[model samples]
Target: MFDVAITNGLFFDGSGAPGAIRHLGIRGGKLVAISSEPLEEGAQQTIDAHGQWVMPGFIDMHTHYDAELVAAPALRESVRHGVTTVMIGSCSISMVLSGAEDCSDMFTRVESVPREHVLPLLQARKHWNTPADYATFLDSHPLGPNICSFLGHSDLRVAVLGLERAVDASVRPSDAELRQMEQLLEQALDAGLLGLSSMTNPWDKLDGERQRSKSLPSVYAPWREYVRLNRVLRKRGRIHQGAPNLVTKLNVFAFLWESMGLLRKPLKTTLITLMDVKADPWLAPILGPLTRTLSRLTRADFRWQTLPVPFVTYADGMEFVVFEEFPSGEAALHLASQDLRSELFRDPDYRRRFREDVDKRFGPRVWHRDFDDAWIVDCPDQALAGHSVGELARARGMHPGDLFLDLLVEHGPRLRWRTMIANHRPKVVEKLVAEPATLIGFADSGAHIRNMAFYNFAVRLLKLVRDGEARGQPAMPLEQAIWRLTGELGEWFGVDAGRLALDRRADLVIVDPQHLDAGLEAYHEDEMEGFDGLRRMVNRGEAVRATLINGRIAYRDGEFAADLGQVRGYGQFLRAG
Candidate 1:
């Protein structure tokens, strides 16, 4: 008899094929049979998914859940949204291959993960000194979704060079250091890490008050280092993922050419965090030619990972790293005391400098030329709540910057503001989403916890695409959308569980499309330590009837499966085949 059976469902199968009525049989945590025949009577458990659509569970290709996995083993936010597998250690940040103290600081700076939350947990747990040790550590603490990690280049550098020297912009790894890094990569790959991930975006800065904080360690690595790394990845049949410098078209195009063309054997390259650069209109023109050039490259395969939703940031204060783009913004962020920062905002000279810097740096396009797009979401003064910064500035006959400072002075630094950063152009977003080459991910889950919550993006996108279709202009077929989230990404990353075939891993999600909701509500939860009212976003989609991981029901009927004991580590640690 099967362990469980799901009957009478419309199955999308994650194959980009049309949906059809099907029945699935699960046993020993694998899909043993899928057919039209009803196999419910002999099963120990049965789910009558009569009106739902069953598809392979989603694979979130980009996330920063590396450190958070141990602390929050349930991974409720991700599993609730039907994500059964998560790819962590993206943008070159991972806990393995480095000291715990250094990993804690790096997680705090690069991913906005609280040091207090991670440090104490790491101290209590058995130390993981190598990638294999880390994998074993993860295996001991099971989560709701399977996790696959990449060896972070930053941590690799820090392991070879001390943390102090690793961040030094001028310092380059010597031949010996490079060889050490290569050896570590080999060890990590053998230990089940997918491959190496790096970050070269100049804007991707480490959060701290110290010098050499301008860019991540991977940014300072010479091109030859990357070439050597790529060669190593090719030798092991692994992929390379990174965020290329996108400040200019030439920078992006050149990086692509070099990354793809430098090595004799093409490595599967996944470039991440691609978005609609509203600040630079020339980016659109550059993408067209660059994509064509990448297409012509025979050896390498390239795909851009993007978040198709509007780029909105909701933050309580200048603590958000995005504000660091403006001069002196970094200084304000580094101030340990919120009251001290508030006092600084009240200073006339400081206010003047902020105004001048904002004007000089961002000019009118700071809010994408729409000042009304930036508004106060929560404030101490009830009258100011939901009011735009522009409106308040106009009322006081003050510059927006001055008014912003005045508000901070009045309400302290904890006033919450929501700003539309980019991707406000619906047509542009639609175009990007429709592109076959673009991978539908960049959730940044388990990172930027307080500043923003994008963990529910998968369900949100499903609702958006379906809702658009109901309005007549479909973004893409539902089958295609499923494929983007599942088979396409799973295949590219060499994961075998995205498709709903016989003998495949039973990672599945059941959705009632007719009842799916587009709106998501953000709430504060004390999930992380030291940070009060940490924000988490949850999909309101009651349509998700059940989600199964490895044939075990992880979530069902708007609740996580209660049958699984207290240590609900039902998830497997996925390794590249």
Candidate 2:
């Protein structure tokens, strides 16, 4: 007898196979049977998945749920959209190994999570001091989705060499400190971490009293430090997840060189990201040939992470992170006090510098300085809503850059705007989605909560593939797309939650294909449960009919299980295979 049964569903087993009519039975949190014929024995519960597509639950490859996982284990934001497994501790901000204060400092700014919310929560609820302690805490929690983690390099550096020394560029770790870092990494791997995640992207800065606004600890580390750490990952056959310095992008070759396996085993490396940015129209095309060349010419195991959908971003005034990428914007963001920020905004010198920075169109940047691309979503003056800031600036005979500052000083966060950050060109994005060397991820799921809304990144990817095919511009076959998100990522990172086969863990999703439409792209917000009236940007849609993890339906038909967040049986920690 089955504990739970799904019948009459067209299931794709995450093997890149075409859909087949199949019935699956779950028993003791494992797939006990998968058959073409309906099961003869009836069980405790049954779900008639008639027209829905039953596939292995989607795996979110990138997220910053370190704090949210502690605050709200349900993770309904991602889980309800069919994500069964979530990879946390990406972008060099894991909560493991570091003290709560240090971890919170490294995290809050870069991820855009509020400092007050995260810091206090960590101070109160956090007790873990090492990977094993963190892992044990997770084992006891009723996790909404299976969790796997990378040992964050910033966390390691901060733990070993105080936050000050960690971010001090002149203060390279002594051999003893390096040894301590290596030992911590080893202990993490022993406790079943995926691998190391480092950051060279100077844009991601620190948040807190100490080392305030300094680049991440990993950024301060010399190449030798990464080499020592990568050695451990290489020996263990684990993965190295990193980001190249986005401003210059010259450090990418070093990461590439480290990945080569001409004589020695190549380090399995994945970097963030591969985007079609409006700022650099040439980047998307050049990265293609570069990726192909690396794949063809070198004996390296390297992959570029790509977001599969349009990179539309919603910002509450100037509270977005991309502002931290440039010097002038960084200056404004450095002042945490609203009064000080306003003073800076009022300063003519600051405005002139900002305008000068904006004028440098050829300068390397992530946000194109063109304010014309951004449209107001909300404002104190309702008439300004839905109008591009640039056009209004032109109408007022003012530079777009000047008007941007004026509006920010006038409205603060009461104003909201949306802009196309990248992947605006459909043809280029379709090609990137199908790029074999590029992984379909970079959703930045749990981070940038107020400014980014891609909780349903997996669903978006599927819709992109489905619609593209309908438009006679198929990126890849539907099966292949499924495999990319599920089995392919699972296999690469050694996480075990992707495929569906007899005896495998019962983690799956039932997707209603007809509901995969434009609604998934709708802009919406839900007040973050713990934070008082803190409305976070989110995606709302009816695409997923059901999501099951560990033989139990965690979400079905828009209703979450009553015990989804309170009980321990829904999901657990997924160790690397």
Candidate 3:
């Protein structure tokens, strides 16, 4: 008898094809039968989709849920958004291959995850010595979605060289240290890691004693180190995921050329996270050259991953990672107490210095330079809601920076701001999405849990493409959007879970297209416990009627199923082929 049967549903098979009404039968956690004829002979449970669209559950290719998977295993927020599988360990940050203390600080600095919450969880549950140990630890926990990981380059450096030297940009690993890193990577691959992930973004800083330190350890590594690692990944036919230096277009192009062209044997799949085209006008001119280079490359399949919408960050205080870009801003960010930070902001000298330093260094071209882009989303004063900083500053006859500091000082830690950091042009994003080689990613789900929200891109894109217009044209068709979010990502990651077919794992989502706009707004929620009441942006998935993982109903009717009896561990650790 089949475990469950879904009938009369509009099925999008994740292949960019038109939806068709079909019946699906599930047994032993796999799709056993998919036929136009209903097979209701023997089924333990049945779901009448009633014209709802049944598509493969979404796969988020870029996320930072490495530590959170152990700290908060339920992962309900992601599951609610129709994400059935998540790829963590992005930007070269993973839980394994480093000590718990180092991992905690690195995560806190780079990803903005709370160290207090992560450290204890790592100490109590995580096995930090090896990748096999880490995987075993994850298996012991109950997960809501299937988890896959990449071996972090920073973790490898920390494991071999100490944290201090790893972050030192001047230091390069010796021959022995390089060999050790290679051996560790091989061991990690053997233990089921999917690939290698690294980042060279100048903005990715480490937590230093007095202030934020230099770039991540991986960035300091010479080109030889990356080429060697690429060779290792090539041998296994694995992917090489990276976030290139976005500060300069030449740096981005150089990384791509070296990674793909200079290597003896090019990496199979090299994916780089591209900055939002509208975020910086400087990046817009490079897109054409980048695309041309990608097209000319014969050795590797080079592609860029981008967000379908602008990158937004909602914060109650100035503790976000982006603020660390300013001089002395890192010192201000380390002040854990909001009251202390408010006092610092109230200091006249500090405020003046901060304003002068920012103006001198960044000028007017930076994305965050225009205070009008920042809106007061949440505050004690309801009158200020939806108002931008520029408007309020002009009314008070003060500089925007001065007014912003004064407001923070007045409100202390209770104030909240919503800032758009990238991708102001939806038309540009649509054009990028329309490109067959572009991958829609950069969700950044678990890392910036308290400060930013991009976790519900799958559902948001679906709605946008169908109803929203961009560049005087409607967004891509729903079928194409589904394929980009599902099959394309699954194919790139070498996973079989993103398609609805016989013999595939039965991870499915049933959605009501008519009510897709309902409950789609992003709101604040305090879900992570023991993290100083920090609130994360929760994008509600209103249209999702049900989500099934491996043939079992994980969520239904806007609530997670109770059948698991509070032990929701239906997900498996997907190893690379």
Candidate 4:
């Protein structure tokens, strides 16, 4: 007998096709049938998805859940929103091939997760030393969703070169060291990792007393080192998740060129982001066309990840990564002591340099840096009374840059402010997401804990399309939207997921399209259960009526199964195909 049956549901099948009313039978963690015929009546459980749209569960291809997957394997935050698969080891951080301390240092600062919680958990439980063992560790845990990961370049580099030497800018890997890295990557691929994820973004820093403020180890590698590793991925027909040196942005073409098959088999490259930033209005318009040209003309297979919704980011005093874009801001953050940063914030010389940079408005910044664009969302000081940074600066007759530094000196971390960094222009954002060379991503889920809240990005994208179609300006077909979050990504990543074919793994969600609305944008907080009262920003919505991972209803009827991560039924480690 089938374990479950979903009847009269609008099935999308993750194929970018129109949804059709169908009945699906699930048996033994696989799809039993995909047909319009009536489901045989004797299923042990049944879901009457009368009006709901059933599709393959959304795949979250960008997440920093590497540590959280260890701390709380359920990871209900993404699962609740219909994400049944989560990709970790993003931005050159992964748990494989590194010691607990090294992994913790590499991750905590860049991802903004608490090291105190992550480090100790790893120190106690992290015994695995290789990619295969890491996969085994995950299998032992009651994972909430299928997990796929890239072998982080930083992890391999640090493991082979020692953390001290890896982060040192002057220390280049020897030929021997490069071979070791390749060997580790080969091991990772053999262990079924998605591929290699590398970082050229200098803003992502390492944590720990020794490596503090140093950019991730991947940032220390030279172009030759990267090319050597990229070859391994290319040869294996694996993906390369890359981020350009954002400060310079010249590396973008370098990555794209490597993705071309003109001289060799194209490496399937997917880069971090393409957004309509307020700081550079011309960038997105140019990039969309250029990327499409490269994709078609070069016979290259690469996709620029795009966020489908508005990019709102939160910052507390001076703890945001955008600061790393400029010298003065980076100097302040480089200080290990919070008091030192505060003192530097008030230093006249430092302020002079920062103000000069602000006036010049440095090229290629994600944040607009306009004080008017940022607002004080929370502050303990009663006198300021929730004014935008620009208002406070204007009141004091000081430049917004100068006033912002002064605020940091006084109310660090306690003073929370938010800004719409990019993707704020709805029409422009709609077009950007629709680009053929772009993929629906950059959700940055499980990263930027305080700074971002795009957990429901999939639903938000759906909502964006739904709202647009209602106004008679459809960005693309709704079926296409679902496919972007589902089959497109799953196919690209080579995961055994994101389709509702008969006999396929029963991984799907029931989305209530009628209830999908603006409420999905609302953000709230849930205290991270094991993390010493740390509150994480999360999205809450009713659109996801049910999420089934491998034939089990992990979340349904507005409630998560109580035993989710405590039991093995919810999910298991999913190796890359």
Candidate 5:
């Protein structure tokens, strides 16, 4: 008898075959049969999958759960979205310990993880002291879904060379240091880490804030290590990196080419979301030529993922304030940057240099642009949710800047606004989404805590592609979208499970796609730590009826089974084996 059976279901197997009407029989948590034949003796349980779509569980390739995973391993946010497996340690930030030295300073500077949040956790509950040991800790925990990590290059840089010295572009590592990092990478790979990942960007606070003064060395570390590590991995595992900054576009293109050259094998490297911004018009200019060259000459593989949404939702009255605008707004921000931000604020000549180099070139554009009263979708306070800060300002007869400043001042560092400025038009999204080499992603779920609304990416795809099909400009086929979100991602990463094949691990999500709406649910304060409100989210397959990991139910109905004692350690620790 089968352990479970789903009858009358429309099954779209991960192989891209046409949908077939069949009943799926699960035995020992793997799909054992798909036939019209009546049940053998007696199945333990059955589900009427009627009109629902059943496919492989999703694989989220890009995520930042560095600190959060240490606290809550159930991974509620991802499992809720039908994501059965998630890859973290992207953008060169890793949670693995390095000897007895306090690497907390490295995280604060490179990744912006708050010292308060990281230090306390490291001092208290963090048990692992090396990459391999950290992987062991994750294996020991009761994780709800499968977790495979990458050895972040930033961590490697700090481990080999001190954080202070690793940033220098010319500071080539000593042969011993290089060998040590290589050994560390080998250890992590043997411990089951997927590959290495990194990101490159200079600091700039969006919202038309002041420019971040001084160039740091960490920026060069990621690019240098990309070539070094790819040669070592020999394309055994994939490399994931994010390169969205305009200032570094040229550098990014060069580094991408360098990494591809080093691969010299049929291996894939995924570049993060190519944002739909006008300033980034050269995305195709760079990728188009590179694709042609790689197909004709190089045996390497290159791919990109797109978000199909704005960098941030502008409905929250948030807009990206480029560093170019910082000079004009320098006076206000510099005064504001005092005290806690005094390290950067203390340099008066640097502020003067910013003013001279910045304001002289872009004076009128910063002064005259009208961003007065734009409609907003959600706010921390429900009363102010839909109202614009500009409109509120006019009603109270104050300048829009004052209203914006007041909120930032009151909310302090936590103030954030979603923006629609990146790709203000749908045509841009359509063109990018239809590209063959592109996959749908850029759901920076655990990152950009105050600024980004990540849960909306899946819903946006449904709305734009499914609902907008009549326009004859749909992004991708629903079947392709499903595969891209699930099976394809796993195949790209060399993970074991992104399909419903027999003998494979059972990590699955049951989602109701129809009721999924394109609106952000208000903040619900129910995280494990009780850290106030987080934006409540529901995607196409959000109302997860059940989530199974390694043939056991990890989460079911509305509660996490790990917490409910339905299963013990349903998650499996994946190694290179």
Candidate 6:
């Protein structure tokens, strides 16, 4: 007798292959059969998945669930969206320090955790310090879904050569330090981590603080280390890399192609498309040559993901602020939002001259939406929505910029002013998704807390890709999207869950594609740790009817089962091999 049976559904097995209408039988948490053959006389529960899509559980390749995963292992936000596995420690950040005395204090630099709150909690709970120790502790927990982590480059660099010295190019690493980094990687993998992850872009704050502080230059490792590390991990692990300093439109894709060209051993690279600073309609043309280069390359498999939107924070004076290394990126950020930054925003003459100079150098480039043309679409309470700054200024008979500053001044320097910056052109997003090599990702959740959240893209893509096109359907088959979201991602990351094959982890979702919906209404009130922010969301998959991780029902009809250990300890560390 089987443990469970899902009868009457279209099975898209996450293999980029065609799906068939069939009944799926499950026993001991594995898909026992998919057939017209008679299901064995019942030994357990049966779910009638009538008129639904039954496919492998999704594997979210990019996410920033690092801190939260340690605190709340249930992975509520992701699991509810039908994501059964997640890749953490991207952008070259992770918690691999040893004996941090206070986990919260450590997170202040590594994550967005506020000092006062995280400090106390992490201090009380941080028992393990090394990557191996962190993995062991998390693996022992009865999590709602499986987790795979990448050894962060920053953390490794910091660990091997303290934060101060790691970036000091002059301070050549001794043999001891070099061996230490290699040892950390080995330990982390042995403890169940997959491979290493590094960021091409330095953290924003690092650039801001460099000015006036005489900060150490960032130690972006040479290609040799990356190559050696890739070779080491490829023997038994995998590598997930985010591109270097994103200043230009094709910076990420360009650097990735160059890096792949350098590697003697075949390795996979995931290229991230950060939101664009320009509003040019011809953005696709600029990206075309790079994408063409990507198409011609077969030396290594590459994955592409995009960050579709930017965050808006209305509580604090945090408006649409984008910073790059200018003078010093670090010192500039620290002063950018300060009273000093007013010089950049308030002085019309200065702003106009700066714009004029920039244009003369690089042609007319669009940055944020012009202050005069900006509007207020959403606000914290009912008092402030559907009004433009210009309109607000006219009402008060003040300048538009004056009105915006007044609102911020009233809320104090800490008061927030949020703006919705839509950088994606539907056509561009469509072209990227149409490619088989691309995977949907870059939901930097839990990291950019002050920013808006739109990480829930599974259903959103259906609306945009399916409904946004001329034919009112997707360019790629729906089955292909489903496969990428589930099986292909799992296979790429070596995750155990995203398939319906026998012995596959029972991470499944029943989707009602017809009734699927996503938008403002789907945004939930919960902020995990009470951080004020907006979340883009959607509702679909028939309430996720039942969630089985490793064959045990972790969630069913909004109710979690009594025991949650079936899915526990099943995740294996992914190595390059």
How would you encode candidate 5's per-residue C-alpha lDDT over 1-577 as one tens digit per residue? 8777767766666665656667777777677787765555567767676666666777766777666666666667766656677777776667674422244444432333344665666667767757778877887776666787877776677677865466566688776877788788877877888777665654422111121222322356544555667666764555545553444346645545654544356445667655565434445435644554664465546677777665543312222334223453433332334343333333556445543543243322212223342344455655655676667878888655555545644443344444344555577676666666576676765654444445545545545666556577667776666676677767767777677776666666554556444433333323333122333222333444566666555656656653622234555555543
- Candidates arranged by lDDT, highest first: 2, 4, 3, 1, 5, 6
Which candidate gets the maximum lDDT versus the true structure? 2
Q: In model 5, what lDDT does residue 409 have?
A: 43
Per-candidate Cα lDDT values, in order, are 0.75, 0.89, 0.76, 0.88, 0.57, 0.57
Q: In candidate 1, what residue range of length 10 has the lowest lDDT sum?
A: 361-370
lDDT of 5 at 300: 48
In order of appearance, the predictions have TM-scores of 0.93, 0.98, 0.92, 0.97, 0.80, 0.81
Error of 2 at 416 (Å): 0.9
For model 3, residues 413-478, the per-residue Cα lDDT tens digits are 567887777776766667767665568888888877767777788887887786664334677777
Backbone clashes for every candidate come to 0, 0, 0, 0, 9, 28
lDDT of 6: 0.57
What tens digits encode model 6's per-residue C-alpha lDDT throughout 264-377? Answer: 544566766533334455554355445546655746556666543332323234322242333322333355346666544456664444344322434323344344445554
Write the residue-wise lDDT of candidate 1 on 1-577 in tens digits.
9888999999888889988999889988888988888774588889999988899998988988877676666677788778899998888888887776667666776677666667676667638879889888777775778888999988888898887788777788889989998999999999889999988765556544453255677877887888878878888888888877644424455446544645465567778745676665545434644674665654446777877687787766565666655556756765767788888888888888888766664432223433466688888887888899889888888898888877777776468888777666776777677675578898888887766677767666777788789899888888888888889888888867679888878999988777666445344444552234454433355767788988998898888876432364477788886
C-alpha RMSD between model 4 and the true structure: 1.5
lDDT of 2 by residue, 1-577 (tens): 8999999998999989998999999999999999999999898989998988899999998899889889888899888899999999898889997888999999998999899899988999999888898889989998989999999999898889888888888897889988998999888988888999999989888888877899998898899999999999999999999999987899989998999887899889999999899988888978966876885688888999998888988888778889987789899888888778888988999999989988886766888867888999899999999899899999999988899989988998788998888998988988898887798888898889888878898888889888988989788898998998898989999978789998899999999889999999898888875565666888889999999999899999999999987989988888875
Q: Model 4 clash pairs? A: none
Top TM-score hit: 2
